[model samples]
Every structure is written in C-alpha cells, then in structure tokens.
Target: MMKIAVIGTGYVGLSTGVCLAEIGHHVTCIDIDINKINLLQLGNSPIYEPGMEQLLTKNIENGKLLFSTTHKEGLQGVEVIILAVGTPQGENGAADLTILQQAAKDIADYLHNNPIIVIKSTVPVGTNDSIKEMLEDHCKKEILIVSNPEFLRQGSAIYDTMNPDRIIIGSYKKEASEKIQKMYSPLNAPVLITSVRSAEMIKYASNAFLANKISYINFIANLCEQVGANVDEVSMGIGKDKRIGNAFLQAGIGYGGSCFPKDVKALLHTSLQFGLNASLLEETIAINDSQQELLVVKALQRFGSLNEKKVALLGLAFKPETDDMREAPSIKIAKQLTKMGAEVAAYDPAAIDNAKKILGDIISYTQSIKDAIKNADAIFIVTEWKEIKNIELSSVLKEAKLPIIFDGRNCLNKTKIMECDSIEYYSIGRPAIIKK
Candidate 1:
C-alpha cells in the first residue's frame, strides 16, 4: 500500500483521503484549520456526506487514515502528495490560485523525498503545468506532477470516488502516470492517461457540458410552459435516445452546488481569455440566473405583491443528501422573498446551520416540513429533498393558510396535484393547477 498525503480537508480532500484509505492505502489528510483537523482526529467529519464518517472512522481505527494541521507532519515518509485545495472563483469569474500557490510553497519545504504531486483539485487548463513549474522552481528539483481531477458529486462523493466511471491521469512522465495508476488499481476502473493540459481541460469541459445540459433543458422547460407542453414528458422523450443521456435533464431552478456554476464561469472566462466565441456558455449562465428567479416571478405574478405574506420554503441546501449551500438557488430565492416583504420560513434536513449563516435572521428556520408550511400563505419547493418530496398534500392543505405552492425543482407529482381540486400547484415548465 502507498503512503499518501492530501492537502486541504474540505469535501474533495476528505472524501478522497477516506476512500483511498478504504482501498488499503495509508493516508494523512492535512488542513490548516485546527478545528477541522481536531474533529477529524476524533473520527468526526466536518462536512456532511453519505457514508463518509463510517468509512473515516473505520479507516482511522484500522490505522489507514490520519489527519494533521501541519504539512511537515503529514508529508513525512509519504510517497505521493495529492493537492486538493480550493480554487474559488476570483475576479472576472477566473479561478483564484492564491490558496493553491501557498500550498505548493508549503509542500516545497518538505519535498526531500521525490513524491508524485497529484492535483485532485478542479483547475483551469494548463494549471497543472504551471504548478509543476512552481514546485520545481521552489524545491530546486524535478518533481513529477499528475493532473488527477476529481469528478465527485457533493452528496455522493464517497460513492463517486470509490466507483469512478474512469480515472483520467494526466502527466508527461510515464513513471508519474503509472504510479497514479498503481495507486488507484484497487478500484479496477478504466484509466485514461493523457497530456496534463488535456486532463485539466477534461474536468472543466465535463462539468461545463453538464451545466450546458441543465441550461439546455431549462431553456426547453421555459418553452414548454409557454406552449403548454409537459417538460417531464419532453425530457423523458429526448432522454430515451442513447446519444442524449438523461443525466442532467431534470428541469429545475438551474444548476447549483459547487461544481457546475463555478466550472461553467471559469470555462467561459478561459474561452474569452483565448479570444474564442463562447456565447453558448454565456447563455447557459444567463439562463440559470433567470431560472433561479423564475419562482419569485411566479409568486409576484400570482399575488401581485408579496407584502408581508407568510411564505414557506422547503429545502435550503443546493440539493439533497448534503449540506453544501455554495451557489445554492435557495439563497437567491430567500433574499428575493425577504426583499419582497415575504415572511420566509425555510426547512432542510441538512444545511440549516450553514443557511442561517448566509441568511441570518432575515427568514425564520423551521425544524420540519410541517413546521415550515404551517399557516403559510404560499409554499415554494426549493431543493428536492426526499423529506420535502414525500410531504403529504392533504396535510399541506390542512395546515397552510392559502394552500398555494410553487415548486422550483418540480418535486411533487403533477398527477397527484391534479387529483386534488382544492389546492393550487405551480412548477417549472409545467402547467399550473390553479383550482382553488
């Protein structure tokens, strides 16, 4: 088993380290946050991901997983160092490399043993090469750099990592490529070895394309509403074709979470930097921005104004099964509701604490779906959490003051809503059931 050191203890780093250790590798995950390191040492995951804490506790008990705040301590005797630091969006939508640059500098101090530097962070094209240059310049030795970008969903990161569709290893050196291949050999997934730049581009290209699919479907969803065509049926019809997979065909309040939004903007920034026409990406982002506000527009159109109306929002996190609220559509929706003088009460099985930080006391936080919707004039389904999706319409009609609902994610069944004659149901790209 290989000894590996992973920098940063965020979602990507922690998930990668835990899964690697699960596959029988000795892994030390280092983070600058002392609290995160301490919590991890006690077998607690700082982030919420399915089956992460179990694997983390298991690996730690098996002596396969480790955590530290210092790079020197974590880097000692490690054969591979995976850089999974955050590259948040900076000015003009380009990826900010300040944190990554600092990590490289810190890693350079402990590179006495030649270790393969694997970049598991999602970066722009040619970033791996630039990092290689920086590391070599700092250490004054030739270092092998491998661009091994991660393709993890926020909610199912552990499953995605362990059961990856394909592992793309990008490195010029045959030794570096083979070493990364050997590291992940236990997974038995298909491996694609390519140039570093191409590998870096692959990550952005893949995420942007998924974002494009989301925007494309949302674009069609808007048309379906105008033409009285059901988006669900249209999505299913188009998705049946093998060439057009049904992955991101769900027409919702645009694509959110950490990956799709940032990657699309970063790629658009890259295209503009190279003097290329990227109007499609531009429009993709434009469609998403408008989609986020679609529910609010509907609410305003329905009530004429949201002056002190008690509006209950179901689901605050970007998606289900995770507490990640970065770039979540609920943020915009909450702010708009509050601005329009709506008393917003939001409920999420997870992400309430995180949402409170961003939302503050502007809106009330509810413990359950029933608590959020009780006595509300209107209800808006933001995230399609199972808890929110399984909410009984009978209870809603009994509890709500207005029994009017706007589903942003299309979580409820239209057929069920049609069966109920007293309730009003509105959803994205679907005909509204306004039988009150």
Candidate 2:
C-alpha cells in the first residue's frame, strides 16, 4: 500500500483520503482548520455526502486513515502527496491557484525525499508544470509532478472514485505514472497516460461538454413548451439513439455545482488567454444564466406580480444527496424573487444552514415542505430532491393560499396536479396548466 498525504480536508480531500484508506492505503489528511481537523479525527464529516461519514469512521477505526492540522506532520515520510485543495474561480474567471501554490510550497518545504506529487484537484492547463517548477526550486532532490484529475461527482463521490470510468494520469515520468496507476489498480478502470496539459484540459473539457448538453436541452425544453411538445418525450426519444445518452438531459433550472460553473468560466478564460474565442462556452453560460430568470418570469406571469406573494421553495441545495450550494440556481432564484418584493420560504433536506448564510433574512427558512408551503401563494421546485418529487400535491395545495405550483425541475405530475380544483401548474419545457 502507498503512503499518501492529502492536503486540505474539504470535500475532495476528505473523501479522497478516507476512500484511499478504505482501499488499504495509509492516508493522512491535512487541513489548517483546527476545528475541522478535530471533527474529522473524531470520525465526524463536516460536509453532508452520502456514505462519507461511514467510510471516514470505518477508516479511522481501522487506523488506515488519519487527520492532522500541520502539513509537516502529514508529509513526513509520505511516498505520494495528493494536492486536493480548492482552486476557486478568481476575479477574471481564471482558476485562482493560491491554495494550490501554497500546498506545493508546503510539500516542497517538508520533503524528506523525492516523492511523486499528484494533483487531484481540478486545475487549469499548465498548472502542473508550474507546480513542478515550484517544487524543484524548494526541494534539493528530484520531484515528479503528476496530473491526476478527479472525476468524482458530489453526491456519489465514493462510488465514483472507486469505480471511475477512466483514470487519466499525465506525467513526464512513466515510472511515476505507473506507480500512481498501481495505486488505483484495484479500481479496474481504464487508465489514460498522456501529457500533463491534456489531462488538465480533459477535466475542463468534460465539464464544459456536460454543461453544454444541459444548456442545449434547456433551450430545446423551452421551445417544446412554446410549441406544445413534451420535453420528457423528446428527451427519451432522442436519448434512445445510443450515441446520445440520457444523463444531463433532464430539464431543470440549469446546471449548478462546484465543477460546471467554475470549469466553464475557467475554460473560457483559458481560451481567451490563448487568443481563442470560445463562443460555445459563452453561449452555454448565457443559457444557464437565463434559465433561472426564466423560472422567475414564469412565476411573475402566473401571479401578475411577485409583490407580497409568498412563494414556497422546495429545495435549496444545488442537487439532491449533497450539501454543496456553490453556484446553486436556488440562490439566484431566491434573490430574484426577493428583489421583486416576493416573500420566499425555502426548505432543503441538508443545505438549510449553508443557504441561511447566503440568503440571510431575505428568505424565510422552514423545517419541512409543509411548513414552507403553508399559506403560500405559489410553490417553486428548485432542487430535484426525491422527497420533493414525490410530495403530495393535494396536501400542499390544501395548505397553499393560491394553489399554484411552478416546477423548475419538472418534479410534479401534470395530470395529478391539474386534477385539483383552483390549482395551476407550470413546469419547464411543458405547457402550463390552469385549472378550469
């Protein structure tokens, strides 16, 4: 088993460290936040990810995983260092490499020998090369920098990590790449050995393509609504073509997460830096931006105006099974409705605390969907939670003041919702239903 040190105990770091340990590797997760490290050391997960807490607790109990606040402690005698820190979007939409650079410097400062450094965070092109230079300047021995970008989704991070579709390792040294490959040999996934730049570009390109697919479907969903065609039917009909899969084809309030938004902007920034105009990415972002407003506009059309209207929001997190609210469309929708003088009441299974920080006193927080819809004029489905999708329309309409449902994620059943008296239903890429 490889001895690994994972810097930064955020989602990627914590998950990677624990999951690696579960696979029989010795892992040390380092974070500067003492409270976070303390919590993690006690087998407590700071983030709400499915199966993460159990895995962390199990690994810790088995002594396969450990947490520390000091990078020096974590990096000592570590054969492999995986940089999984945050690379948040900077002012100009480029990836701010501050955290990555600091991690590299720390690795350089504490290097006892030549260890293979792997970047598991999503970084822009050429970052691996810069990291190599930084490490070489600080270390007296040779250091191999490998680009091993992660492709794990938020909700299913552990499963995705263990059973990845492909593992791309970009490194100048074939031996370093092989060692990293052997570390993941149990995964049995296809390993792609390529140049560092290509591996870096792969992450951005993959996210951008997925974002584009969602935007394209949203565009088509809008057209379907206007032309009286059902988006669900269109999606299924088109998705059956084998080449076009049905993954991101669902019509919703656009795409939102840590990956899609930042990656798209960073790719655009990279293209501009390289003197290439990325019109496709620009349009992709444009469509996603408009989607949230489109939902708000539809609400306005139904209510004539949002002034004093109490709208109940079903979900706050970007997606179900994750507490990550970074760039969530729910926040944008809440702000837009509040700006228009609407009273918003929101509820989510796990993201309420985080949402409370961003939304402040602008939106009312409720403990349950029933509480959120109580005496509300309209109900807006923001995040597509399983509970939200299966909500009883009769119960919600009974409690609602106006009995209107605006589904941003198309969660409600059209026929069932239309059966209720004085109830109206609106959804993306579908005809609106006004009770006769």
Candidate 3:
C-alpha cells in the first residue's frame, strides 16, 4: 500500500506505473505531454503494449491509478518517486542524461519532505550517486538514491515485469533497499542487494552481452552460408549445450530496439572514457552493419538490377508485438531498396503509422501483407511475426510477380518455396534456394 509517483510516461514509465497500481500500490503517473496525459486520464494508453491498456483502464476504475502532467500534484504526498525518464544516447555515445537531470531538479523543487528517489532508467555505473548529490544541493534534504534498473523486454514487458527472474536493488542505505524490496515482496521473485554502481553495471553488461551473442551467431550464420552449412542446424547444435543456453541466437536482420544498440554504444563510450577499448563490441557493431548489406546484396543478385523493381517488405517494426522502431533494420533495407530505384511497399501488423512518420514518401503503405506482395518483384521478411511466419509460401508466391523471397528472419520453408516455378529464395545463414 505504498504510494508511488512514476515520472515520465514513455514505455518504461507507463508500464511501470500501471503495473505497480495493479499490484495494489496507489500509483500516480506524471508526464510533460498534456495530450498524452489527457489520453491516459481517459484510461487510454498512448503506447501499444499487450495488456497494458486493459490493466490501466481497470486500475483507473478501481481508483488505484491516476495520471497528471504536473509533478507537484503527483508528488505531494508520495513516499517514493521513480524516475523513468528517457536516457537517449548522446553525441559521444554516452547516455544523454538531460531528461533524467531535469526530472531530478523538478523533483527537488517540488518535494516538501525527503522521499526515496529510485532511478529505474538504464544509466551509467555511477549515475545514482550523482543524482543524490544533485538533489541534495538543490533541495537541501536527505534524498535516498536507489538504482533499480528495468529489465523489461518491449514486446513481453508485462509478463517480464510480473514474472521477473530477479530484481536488483542498488543503494547505499540498507533500509532504503529493504523498503523497495518489501514493495516487490508480493511477487515472490529473488531480490539482489548490491552497491549502486554494481547494479548500474549489471544492466549495461547484460544488454551488451546479449548484443554480442546476436552478432556472434549472425557472423557464424554468414560463414555457414558460404560453406554450405545450415545455420539453423548449427545454432541448434551449439545451443543444446547448457552453458550456452538458447536465446538471442536467431539469425535475422540484426538486433534493433530501444535498449540493445544504445546500451552497447554507451558501454563502449564508457570504456573509451577510461582510456580502454572494447574490440569485441566494435566488431559486433561492424558485423551487424555488414549483415544488412549482405541481405541487400543477396536480393540484388537474384533480381539482376533493382531499378524500377517493386519490392514488398512484410514487417516494419524492430521486432514483433511492439510498435517501437527506434533502430529497426527494416528502415535501412527499405531506404536502400528505394535508393536503388525500387518501389518499396511495406506493411506491419502494428507500427505502420510510426514507420510512416520516419519513412514518409520513400515507401508505399499497404493494408495487408498479401496486398503488399502483389505483383512485387521481390519480398523481404524483415520482422518475424508469428502470422508472417505462418503464411503459406505457395499462396504468396502465386500472387508475387517474380516469386523471389529474401528471408531476413528465415521465416519461410525452403523446400516449399523452391517447389514453385520461377521461384528463388535466399535466407540468412542458410543455403540459397534457386529454382531452375
């Protein structure tokens, strides 16, 4: 029954606020955007997360959750303030703490008494200590700074939050850590208490390592294609080992989203600041950059020349089930196709509107995947949606002009695609299928 104020209503903020309320805590979500606030006040979600809107609506009806644009109004009697603001990557690849700093200053100016301030944003190793100093200098009150970095994946944020594997709390004060841990005690998840700096490092270290895993498998997949080995088989064979485990090993159009790319870059920047170099991370980024170009090359090789060619892209979001396209490889591939004088028609189950904002006039929008692929010279499966994966290649090829498939996500049955006349199929880390 602790009162919590979650500042900033972006994906992390909104999800955290509503979920907390659902767990029986009285929650207030504060945001600067009046339009977003207005929408939330009506029990509507500005972002598309599975089950978030419904939970938010239920909580609002039950008087457990509220939304506002004013921080003072939300913070008046709140016991804990969670900073969930954006920490976008800056010019030098470090996390830009502009939003976080502003939120801290605002919280300082509005607080009537000392309240525990927890930073849930992914920040550098020592950011919590600095936040404490900044708040104390401004407010002249004892503000407990705790680092409780979020580990929610975009598409499965709700499930991940409710059933987290572990929760890490970083604080100098043992009592502050205990208080936060008590709030989450009902979940029955294991809680790790550690130094503030170690907790911050855990977030970046986890993301950077995942990014490396993806890049590692992608590189192996590329070599498999050249050596006539199946990447799927290779991935399975290696992933069976318990030590390696089987996640983030899928060969696709590279990793993209709000977290992995930015965090990896920020970690590299941190290393550079200490006069150290991260050669592995540097290569991971290089391999990912080259992997996208390889897909384009495979498509062009099959089609001869892309000039005046019509191409259909099946998925536009970075990954499936979320509308975030922060660093989607689809944009790069689509733009490359357009630059080669190919007319690109794209469709996604969600994220078309957001994609249109970034890639306006460069690609045509289609109502459905079938419509997008109609009369197209080539088709690229960029995102691995379950619906897209389940599509019958026999039916889709009948509608396509050239029947050429470049599977960035390896979402097609190679044998079935090759069975069709005039069909050519190419996929990552696998043998290309060319029909005579």
Query: What is the TM-score of candidate 2?
Result: 0.98
Q: Over the stretch 185-225, how does candidate 2's per-residue lDDT look in tens digits?
A: 87789999999999999999999999999999999999998
Candidates' TM-scores?
Answer: 0.98, 0.98, 0.97
Question: Model 1 over residues 1-436: C-alpha lDDT tens digits?
Answer: 9999999989999999999999999999999999999999999999999999899889999999999888889999999999999999988899998999888988998989899999989899888889899888888889899999999988999999999999999999999999999999999999999999999999999999999999999999999999999999999999999999899999999878888988999999999999999999999999999999999999998999998999999999999999989999999999999998899999999999999999999999999999999999999999999878888999998899999999999989777787786998889888888886
Q: Candidate 3 clashing pairs?
A: none
Overall local distance difference test of candidate 2: 0.90
Candidate 1 lDDT trough over 10 residues, lowest sum? 412-421
Q: Give lDDT for model 1.
A: 0.93
Question: Residue 98 in candidate 3 has what lDDT?
Answer: 96
The residue pairs that clash in candidate 2, if any, are: none
**Residues 128-180, model 3: lDDT tens digits:** 98999988888777778899999999988888888898999999998899999
Winner on TM-score (1 vs 3): 1
